[model samples]
Target: MRNLEQVLAHAENHCENNGSRLTIKRKQVLTGLLISDKALSAYELIDFCKGEFGETLQPMSMYRILDFLNNQDLVHKLNLANKYVACEYINCNHEHLVSQFLICVECQSVKEINISKTVMTELQRNVLQVGFHLVRPQLEMNCICDACITSQA
Candidate 1:
């Protein structure tokens, strides 16, 4: 878990660097996502916002906030689960792009790994050889972690 105030401050810096404004609603939604270790669906986020902000927010408003956060690379949407999680690292300089994720099946924890330059180049070459163009390259793999395995035994 992260300090909510620190998360907000970091988010504010991110917005300033990107020349975007972190509106109150966006901050609320982002902070809620940050505090959660697991991914949350849109509806869950709406409920969190209502509980925190004391006002019912529309689905459209939530979607807009999500879209903005995604575009700015502040949050990631897991296609498999149809949920969202705040980026593990917030100060990344790279353009907002899809990322590969490793999910621990037992704990439901997620880790993002950057696509190495060599791997990306090789993938592009192989795809071109097959007369295919790659669009989104995020790969989600399920595996058991050491702690889970040990605890299970």
Candidate 2:
């Protein structure tokens, strides 16, 4: 994985290439997620901005910024947790189909992983068989992390 500075620079370049600017506030929000070890809700982001940068952000405004970041694929929203995390593939140059995450139930640690094309196809087929549309095509699995399990033992 690239360092924070490297990732941020890549994101800036990506946005510019796509004709969208990564504004200061959006950058700040992305920075907050990058520095965090787990997903964060919008309210938590508001507090983070206020504490770290001494800048107050309204909830609605934060949501709008988050929406933009999500659309830009700079960050991803965890539907199950109602929180956001920076995309792990932000620095990658190749296109990827992001579809799943492993979330540590005990520690809230998040790890992004790609599923095989065959598996994705099967999952989509199953959803279609049930007469439900897979709109997001994302999955979040809950499990105990190694650290958490070791500590428990």
The best candidate by TM-score is 2
Give all TM-scores, in the order shown.
Answer: 0.81, 0.94
lDDT values of the candidates?
Answer: 0.81, 0.90
What value does the lDDT take at residue 21 in candidate 2?
A: 92
Off by over 4 Å in 1: 1-3, 92-98
The top-ranked prediction according to lDDT is 2
lDDT of 2: 0.90
TM-score of 2: 0.94
- The residue pairs found clashing in candidate 1 are none
**Taking the tens digit of each residue's C-alpha lDDT, what string does model 2 give over 30-142?**
99999999999999999999999988999999999999999888999998788999998888899878558888888888999998889999998999999999888888988
Lowest summed lDDT over 10 consecutive residues: which window, candidate 1? Answer: 90-99
Candidate 1 lDDT by residue in tens digits, 54-108: 8578999899999999877788888877788888777555564446787777876
What is candidate 2's CA lDDT for residue 46? 99
Error of 1 at 60 (Å): 2.3
Model 1's alpha-carbon lDDT is 0.81
